[model samples]
Target: MTAALHGLLTGLTLIIAIGSQNVFVLRQGLRREHVLAVVLVCLASDVVLISAGASGLGALLRAAPQVVAAARWAGVAFLLGYAVLAARRALRGDGGGMEADARGTRTGRGAAVLTALALTWLNPHVYLDTVLLLGSVAASHGEQARLFALGAIGGSALWFTALGFGARRLGTFLRRPRAWRILDGAVAVTMLLVAGMLAAG
Candidate 1:
């Protein structure tokens, strides 16, 4: 119920953060290259991670308030730092930003899948967002924690499916580097707002 919706909203907020994984997915979607495989891999990984966080790991962290505080601070730091980077990307048109590796020659299905895996598993923030933050929130939900987790999973499915498939429509507009700057600006704002929320909690 409420937990489910909370999970869904939280999940969307975190997943929508512009990052390597997201950019990669958007690029693949635009190229219409192995979209199904990329989407499936991302969705499956989220299921496992979100379940692990909501089911138990979150509770463990809850038992340790100090640890949760530390994570909260770390998240704030990461979010602020990321926001700065995103702003710079928008202003400077940094080639090393999200679109840096986005435009190279397309890889085979296997490579694309592997890249998706790497992008998901390699990022440290994934753990922070899924296992720590989401888990911690679900733990706070008490009896309805499972519902929260499921809702988060639903968010993940909804976002990835839309990003992977719907991005094709935006392919024309995103071709302009200014559109990317605007995208980065929006992401920066989202990150700042989320960071503010985390810091306040």
Candidate 2:
């Protein structure tokens, strides 16, 4: 495969994993809440990160061990906090059932946007996947690395669009409070596990 196609396939494969960002997007999509904004934020972040990676930012990051250390600690804290919130939501019987209540909405737009930002930016795996790994792979292409980055960007856009839009198809099964509780519980477990891995590494 060509470098661009390689990047596209690699990017899709990596991002398709059930990570924190995917879980957040899936929840927002199921709720039909700020889906567009969340998708845009995630897509934009992938663009910037992939571009930076292709441009040798990965080497820069390696040179600055302190930056990675700081980011690691911050990511651990943020992810653990998110895990707690998800656990609480599961326990409280909330975070599912997107149907309108007396108040018209359960989560506000600003909250959704903020959550999207945190999930995308604060996740250490994002940097590892988009920056170090993708960047290193692109470097093998010599001058075609830019094309590789573009391909990665395309994959990111396509995946997020599909994920955000395609998630609503599961609304029937996810309409119940019990379903929501299970989803949130899974999310909480994922967050905790990822955070623990980050801390240990």
Best candidate (score: TM-score): 2
Candidate 2, which ten residues in sequence have the lowest lDDT sum?
Answer: 96-105
TM-score between model 1 and native: 0.65
RMSD of each: 6.4, 1.6
Report the lDDT tens digits of candidate 1 across residue range 138-196. Answer: 98999999999999999999999999999888777676677767776776776677668
- Deviation of model 1 at 32, angstroms: 0.6
Task: Give candidate 1 misplaced runs (Cα > 4 Å).
Answer: 58-105, 173-201
Model 2 lDDT, residue 9, Cα = 91
**TM-score per candidate, chains pooled:** 0.65, 0.93
Estimate candidate 2's alpha-carbon lDDT, on a 0 to 1 scale.
Answer: 0.86
For candidate 2, write residues 112-187 as lDDT tens digits: 8898888877776777778988999999899999989889899999999999989999988987888988988998
